[model samples]
Target chain A: MTAQAVISASDLSLTFTTADGPVFALQDINLTVKDGDFVSLIGPSGCGKTTLLRVIADLERASAGTVSVNGMAPEQARKARAYGYVFQAPALYPWRTVEQNVGLPLEIMGTADAAARVKRNLDLVNLGGFEKKFPWQLSGGMQQRVSIARALAVEPKLLLMDEPFGALDEIVRDKLNQQLLELWAATKKTVVFVTHSIPEAVFLSTRIVVMSPRPGRIIDVIETNLPRDRTLDIRETGAFLKIAQRVREGLKAGHSYED
Target chain B: MPVTVVCLAILVAWYIAAVFMNTVVAEAKIEAAGGGLVNTLDISWSLERPVIPAPHQVVVEVWKTVFTVAPWKVKSLVFHVWVTLSSTLLGFALGTLLGIGLAVAIVHSKLLNKSLMPWIIASQTIPILAIAPMVIVVLGSVGLTGIFPKSIISMYLCFFPVTIGMVKGLTSPDPMQLDLMRTYNASGPQVLWKLRFPAAMPFLFTSLKIAIAIALTGAIVGELPTGAQAGIGSRMLAGSYYGQTIQIWAALVAASAVAASLVYGVGGIERVVNARMGVRA
Candidate 1:
C-alpha cells in the first residue's frame, strides 16, 4: 500500500496588512508530506518558511488556497491535537518544573497516566533526570531539549519544528541534530521542519523544499537518497557533499541572498 | 549605613525645626513669667502646644498612649490603630478582588476594554477626598455606618491601582507564549489560569502594595466624613480641634509605621511567590 499523505498544501497564500502596504509572507505554495517522511523547508530570512509552518499548525491563516493535516482542516487537526510543534525558542513556562512542563499538553488534554507519559517522553529526549529543574536553570540547549520532550509527550503522529536549534551554538546544534535523527528513526513519525541552514536540511530531511523571499515560494524540492540510519560523519562523504552542493545551488538559482 | 545615616540626619533636623518653630511662643511665655532665655531651648522642646512638637515629645506621647494605657481603652493608641487597620485591611481585600475581577473582564472582552478602561481612568481624576464624604453620607443613610462606610471609601481609593496593574499584568505574556497556548487549542479560561495568571504574579503583588497603602489613606479620610470616633484618623481630628500638636504628631508617626509594615508584609509574600516560581532573588 502507498504511504498516506500526512500534510498537503495547495496554492496557499498569506498576506500581512501593514501600514506601508500588503506584505506577501507566503504565496502559491504547494507541498505534500507522506507518512514517516522528514521534510525540511529551507531558505533565507523573509522566505516565509516559518510562516508556512505556522499555517500548517493553524497558528497563522492563509490568505487564499487550501491546506490540510491528516485530511482534516487545519483548525480541526489542531483541535484534534493531530500534531506536536516545537518552536524556535524553547517556550517553556518559567514557573513550571521540567517534568511539569513536559506534561503540560497531557494535563490540558486530561489524559490518563500522565506522569508515565511524561516520563517516557523525557527519556526519549535523554532528559529523564532533569525533570525537577526549572527551564531557566537549565542551559539553553538543555532547555530546548526539554521543549522537545514536551512536544513528544503529546504522542502525536506528526511533528512540526521551526528552527528548533537556530539559537544554539554549532557544537550543541550538531549534538541535537544527531539526537533528533535518532529520535525520528525510533518514533517513525512524519516531520515538517523549517530552517535556514543548508547542511542541517541536507543531513536531517528525507526531502528538502528550497524556497526564496519576495512573495515567498518554493524553488526546488530535492529528494535525498542518503541512508536513514546515518551519522554526522556522512557530512564528510562525497555523496553528502553532492547533495549539500545541490541545495546551495538551488538557493543561488532563486536569488536567496543568504550571504 | 546610608539608610541609618539618613534617619539620624532627619531626626536632628526635626529637633532643630521644633526649637526654631516654638521660639516665638516660648520667648513670649518666658518674658511674661519674668524668666530669662536661659531655659528657652528646654521649654521650646516641652511646650504646652508647640507648632511642631519635638521628636522625643512625640515618642513619649506614643509610649504613653500605646504602652501605658490598656489596649481596648479609648485613650490607647493601640485601640485607635486597630480600628483603622481593620477597615483598611477589609477595604484592601475587597478592592483587590474588585480590581482583579474588572481586569479579567477587561482583558477578555474587547468591548468591555474599550468601554470601561477610559471611564476607570477618568474616575481617578475626581479627587477621592471630594468623593469620600458623599460615599460616607450615602452609605450612612442606608444604615451602613461604622467600618462599612469607611471601608467603602477606602475601596474607592485603592481599586484604581489594582485594576491598572492587573490589566497590564494579565496582558504581560509575550506574543509567542500566547501563540503557544493557541496552538494547544486551549480554551480562554484554560489560557488564563495556566499562562496569563501565573505570568501576572509579580505585577499583582506590586499593585497590592500600592493598593494597601492607598487604602490606609482612604480609611483616614473616611473617618472625617463618617465621624468615626475610635480610629487613628479620629484621634488626629480630635487633636486638631483641641490644638494638641503632640497627639497629632504621635498619630502621624503611628500611621506611617503601619503603612511601612503593610508594604513590607506584601513584599514578603511576593518574595515567597517568586522563590516558588524559581525566580532568582
Candidate 2:
C-alpha cells in the first residue's frame, strides 16, 4: 500500500507531425509517481514537460508506450474522475461566476453536492468571499487561485499542475507556493507539477524529474533528502543548494545546441 | 444629442437636393413655354411632382399619414409599417434559428464547413431583387401568398450574418479552454450550451443587429414583386405610379424608423442578457 504508484509510464513517446516535419515531442519517457509524493517535472521550453502532463491527464496520447493512472488507462482514469488538472492559465469561463466556474466539473459529473464542493474548494484556496465575482472582476493572481479551487473542487486523489503559478508575479508565486504546499499536506494528494524555475522545482518537490529538450526524455530523477515539514526558507540551506546544483547540472548536460 | 444633429444635417441636405432635382422639371416646363433662365431661379421648393420630395413636404406627408389618418386604414403609414414589421419579425426569428443551426453544424462538422459555407456566400451574390419576382410568383403559384413569401425573402437576407458571426463566436474559445472542457469529460451538448454558446453572445448580438435591418429590407423587396396591397413597399410603389414623390419619401422615412426600433429591440435584449451573464459592455 505504501509503494502504490498513482501514475506509471514506461517507454512513453509522442510525435507530432507538423507542416515542417514530424516533431518528436516525447521520447522514451519513463517515470513512476507514488501515492502522496510531490513530483516536479522541470525542463526547458521544448522539453515536453507540459506535453507529458497533458498525456497523463488524457488530453494527449502517447505514440509508443503504455501509461497508467490509478491502475487504469489514462482515458479510463479521466472518465472515472481520478485526477484534477490545473493548467498554466486560469482558463476560467468569463461568463460564469467564480462559484459556477468552480462547480463546472461537478455539474458535468452530475454530482449532487456541487454547492458544498464549490464552497469548500473556494475556502481551501482562501477565495471564500470572491465566489460571487466573475473571472474578469478578479485580478490575475486571484483568477489563478479560482482555477486552483476549480481543480480541487472534485477532491480527486491525484492533482496534476502544469506551471500553475508560472504566470504570476514573484511575490504572488511565493505566496501560492506556500499555500500549495499546505494544501498538499492537508489533502496528501499525489501531486505532479511542471515548472521551469529552479527554486520552484527544488522547494516544492519530494522527487524531481529533470528533463531535456530535443525529442524530450528524462535525464535525472533526484530524490530530495530535505524534511517533509519544509518551508520556502529551506531553499537557503546547504542541503537544498546541493540538490539545486545537481538539477542545474542535469539541465545543462541535457541541453544540446545542434538540435 | 449628436444623433439628432446628424439627422438634422441629413434633412437639410435632403431638402437642398430636393430643390435642385425638382428645378429640372420647372426649367423644362419654362423652356417649353418660352421662359427658361429667368424662371429657373423662381422654381418652386414645393412642386406637385418633384423628383426628390422636399424634406418638410415629406415630413408633412408622414405626419398626415401617421397621426391624421386612422391607424387601421389602408392609407395610414402605421398600417403599412405594421405589415412590413410583422413579416420582418417573422423572417428574423426564422433566420436566427436557421443561422444558429447552420453555424453549429459548420463549427462541428468539417463536411459542412467545406460544403455549405461557399454556397451560403454564393447565395448572397445572386441578387435577391432579381429573384424576388420569381420567388413571389412561384410561392404564389403554390398558393402560399401574403406574408410567407415576404418572410422567406427576409430569412434569406438575415441568415448569412448570423451564420458567419456565430461560426466566429462558437470557435472563440482557445485551445486551453477546450482542453479544460475535455478534462471535465463534458459531452458535446454540455460544451456547446455551457461554453461555446455563452462565448458567442457578443458576436451573436452584433449579427442580430445586422440581420434585423436586412430582414426589414427583405420584407420590403418581397412586397415589390407581388404588387402588395399592404406594407411600406406597396405604398412606395403606389406613390411611384401616381407620381406622388412625397408619399414615397414618407414611406421611406417610416420604414427606416421601423428598422431602427427593431435594432433597438435586439440591443435591449442584448443588454439584459449580457448583464445576467456578468458580461460588461
Candidate 3:
C-alpha cells in the first residue's frame, strides 16, 4: 500500500451549543490517513470518534482547525463526491428498495446508467438478490450490507465509516468485518473506520487510533505489524491475539484517562 | 373477522328497527281510512299523502331522478349530484396543491414554519357552515359564481389534515439518514426531491383521502344559499321545501357514495405509485 496521506486533520476542535452550556466534543485533534490504509478510531462512548468522522465527511463543521481530503477542503471534497460514509445505524431509506437506495448517490451525482454499478456493488457485498427488498424487511446485518453497497456504488476515493457495525451482534459483526476487509482489499480505497471494539479494531485496521473522552482527543496511534493478507484463519493466529491485546490495553488506558 | 362481523350485524339490526318504525307509521295511516283528510289523535294527514314510503319508494324516486329526468329539471337528483361532485373535485385539487406547497415550504425553511404554522391551525378554528353563505354572497357579487365559492369552502376544510400529515412525513427521516444525505453533499432541492418527497407519499395519500371527504362536505354546504341550478345540496333544500324526506335522504346517500368512491380512487392511485416505486404497502 502507498504511504501518501489521503486525509489530514490539523488541530481540529468542535463545540456544540446545548441548553446547559457549550459542550466541547473534541479538542486539538490531528491525524492523517494514508491512501489504501485501513485505519480504525477506537474510543469510549461519547468520546467524539463519530464526531470526528462526521467532520471529515463534512456532515458537521469543526469549531476550530482545518481538515482536508485529497488536498481539498471538506466541503469541496464533499461536492466532488470524493468519499462515502456509513453511519452507526444502517440508515437506509425505508421507502426505497435496496437497489434504489444503493443507486441514490449516483442519482444525486447525476451519473448515467447506474443500474450496473448498483448490481456490481451488491455483488461485492454478497447482497445480489436482495435488491428488491425494503429496509424493514431485511435483518440488521443484511440492512447494513445494503448500506455498505450503497456507499460502494459511488466508487468513492475514501470510505468513512462511523461505527458502521456497532449495532450488530458479535457473530454478524465479525462476518461483516471480514467481508468489509475483503471488499476494501479488492477496491484498494482509503478507509477510516470507527469502532469501540478492540478485537474488531485489531482485526480490520492497519492502524488503531485510541481516543479518550471528556474533551475527546486521540491518546495513541498503534501500527499493526501483522500481514495484510488477513483471512478468517489469520484471525485465530497468535499475531491477531497479540494485536488485539495491544488494542485492549490502549483502550483501557484511554478509557481510564490515566496517561 | 371478529369485531367487523359483530359491527355489521349490529348495523343490520338497526336498519331492521328503522324499517319496523316505518311500517308502524304505514299501518297507522291505513287504520285512519282513505278520507280526503284523516286524523289519528293530534296527528293528521291528507289523502294526497301516501303511507310512510318503504325503502323501495326512495330507490324508485332515485332511479326516476337519475334516468327519466334530466339534471336541469327541478326534480332531478342527478343534476344536483353532478353539481356537488364537480365543486368537490375542483376544491379537492386546489386544497391538495396548497397543502403540499405549504408543507414543502415549512419543511424547507424554519422561518416559514415559525411564521405560518400557527395561523394555519387557527384558520381551521372557524366553522365552514357559518362562513358558507358569506362566501357565496361575496363571490357571487364579483361574478365569480358557479364552482368557485363552493370550491373555496372545500379548500378550507381539506387543507388542514393534509398540511399536518405532510409536515410530519417530510421531517420523519432518521437523523442518521439525514447525515448520510449530508455526507453525499446533496443540495437542498436534491434532498427534498429524493428523500423528503418520496418519504412523504404515504402520509400525503392518507391525508388526501380525508381531504376528499371534507371537500364533498364543503360542496354540499355551499349549495345551501344562492338557489343553485343543480347539486346534491340544492336537491336537499328543494326536498325539504316539499317535505320529501325520502328524496332528501336519497340525495344524502348519493353524496356519501360519491365521497367514498373518490377516496377509494385516490387510494388506488397511491397504491399504484408506491408499487412502482418498489415500496411494499
Candidate 4:
C-alpha cells in the first residue's frame, strides 16, 4: 500500500466484433498492481486473462474505460519502452542466434551498450553459454528461456508474460518456475503473468486474480502471505497451502456461475 | 556424380535424335541433286547443312566459335553472350527492386493488395514473347534500341515471380510473432526491415532463382524479332537464315549454359548468406 501502483485498470472492457456477433472478451475489469508486485491472472480458457494482460501490453485495444501502465496509457507506455512482453510461444527468429534474438529490442530501440546488457540477461535466465545456438537447435524450454532473456534484455521496469511455460513438460516447467522466481527477486521488476495452472499462480504470485469465462470478468482476488525469499520447497508450507486452497475454492466458485 | 550421369545420358539421347532427324534432310538433298534415293545408313553422318546437326558437329561449331575466334571480336560467341548477359543482369536488378517495393506496398495496405495483385498477375498471362515485338517497335519509335528495349522485356518477365513470392514471404510471420513486434512499439519501417524482410529471405532467394532464368528468356526474345547485330538471339537468327543447324544448336547450348550459371551463382550466394544468418535450411 505504501508503493505507487504500476498498473491500474478501472472499469476496463473490450469487445471483439466477429462474424457471429460482438463477443465481450473483457468486462468491468478493475485491478491495481503496485510497484515490484507479481500479479498472476488465473482462469480457464477463453476467460480473458490473456486478453487482460494484452490490454496492459497494448497488444489489444480496450473498447471502454481507463487503464494505465507505469502512470501512462498502455500505448504511451509501450512507445516509451516501459515494459517487456513474453509471448506464449518462444517466438524467436530462426535466422538469429540466441544473443541476436535477445538483442532485437535493443537494436530496434537503438540502445547503446547492447552487448553487455544482452550478456547479463542471458546469464540471468541461466542460458549463459547458449548464445551461439539458434532457437530451433535448443529444446522448447530452453527456447522459452531465450525468449525471457530477450524480454529482460530491454531492462524494462514491467514484464508481461502470457503462459510462457504452458508448452513445456512438467519437469522443465518446475525448474523454470524456480528460476523465474529467482530472476524476479533479483530484478524486482513488476510482473503481470497470465496462466491456467493453479499451482503456478500460487507458487509465483504476490496476488492472484481469478477470472470466469463467457463475457469474462474477475471473480476473486487472493493475496498471498508467503515469504518473499521462498523457494520451490515452500510449496509444501502451510502458508502456501492455504493460498492454494483459497485459489482452488475461487476456481470452483467460478464454475457454479458457468451455466 | 549423379549430375554428371544425367548430363551424359541427355547427350547420348540428343545424338541419337539428331541422327534420326537429319536422315530426312540428307535423303532429300540426294534426291534433289539427281542422285538415286539414298538409304538411311548411306546418308552421311556429317553434312555441310542438315535439318538437325549431329551432336559432334554442334560441339565442333561451339569450340570453333568460342575458342578459335578472338573473344573481343563481334563474330565470337563470347561477344554475343556478353551482350545478352549485360541486358539480363541489368533487367534482373531493376525487376528485383521493383518487385520488393511493390510487395512491401501490397503487404502494408489492404487497398493495394486487392487492387494491384490481380492486375500484376493478369499481365503475365499475356505472354512475354507476344509482347516483345510490340515493345521493341514502340521503343524503336522513341529511339530506344539495342539493349534498352531488350532489358525492358527482361524486366517485364523478371518482376512477376519476385512480386508474388515476396508478398508471400513478407506475410509469412505468424500472428504471435507479429504481436511480439507490435509489443515493442516498432515503427512500420522498423517492423519491415527487422522482421518481415529477414523472414522473407528464403522465399525471396527462391523466387530470384526463377526470375533470373525468365529474365534471360526475355532478353533472348527481345533480340529475336529485332535481328540485333550482337547477342545469342541474333546468332540463332543468322544461323536459321543460312540453314546452318550447327550454329543454331551451338547458340542454344551457350544460352542454356548462361542460364545454368546464373541460377548456380544465386544459389551459391544464398548458401553463404543463410550460413551467416544461422539458418540451417
Error of 4 at A181 (Å): 0.8
List runs of model 1 lying over 4 Å from the truth: A256-259, B32-38
Which pairs, if any, clash in model 4?
Answer: none
DockQ of each: 0.76, 0.81, 0.69, 0.79
* Candidate 2 off by > 4 Å: B27-43
TM-score: model 4 vs. ground truth: 0.95
Question: TM-scores of all models?
Answer: 0.97, 0.96, 0.90, 0.95
Q: What would the per-residue lDDT of candidate 1 be over residues B94-186, giving only the tens digit for each residue? A: 999999999999999999999999999998899887999898888878888888888887888788999999999999999878887877888
RMSD of 2: 2.2
lDDT of each: 0.92, 0.92, 0.85, 0.90
**Model 4 chain A lDDT-worst window of ten:** A250-259
User: Model 2 - which docking category?
Assistant: high
Clashing pairs in 2: none
Question: In terms of TM-score, how similar is model 3 to the real structure?
Answer: 0.90
Write the candidate numbers in order of decreasing lDDT: 2, 1, 4, 3
Interface RMSD per candidate (angstroms): 0.9, 0.8, 1.9, 1.1
Error of 2 at B26 (Å): 3.1
**Residue B50 lDDT in candidate 4:** 70
Clashing pairs counted in every model: 0, 0, 2, 0
Tens-digit per-residue lDDT, B1-281, candidate 2: 99999989998887677667877677767576576544553454567778887777888999999999999999899999999999999999999999999999999999989999999999999999998999889999999988989999999999999999999999999999999888888999999998999999999999999999999999999998789999999999999999998899899999899889999999999999999999866
* DockQ of candidate 1 (2 decimals): 0.76
Q: Over 4 Å off in model 3, which ranges?
A: A257-259, B1-31, B34-54, B70-74
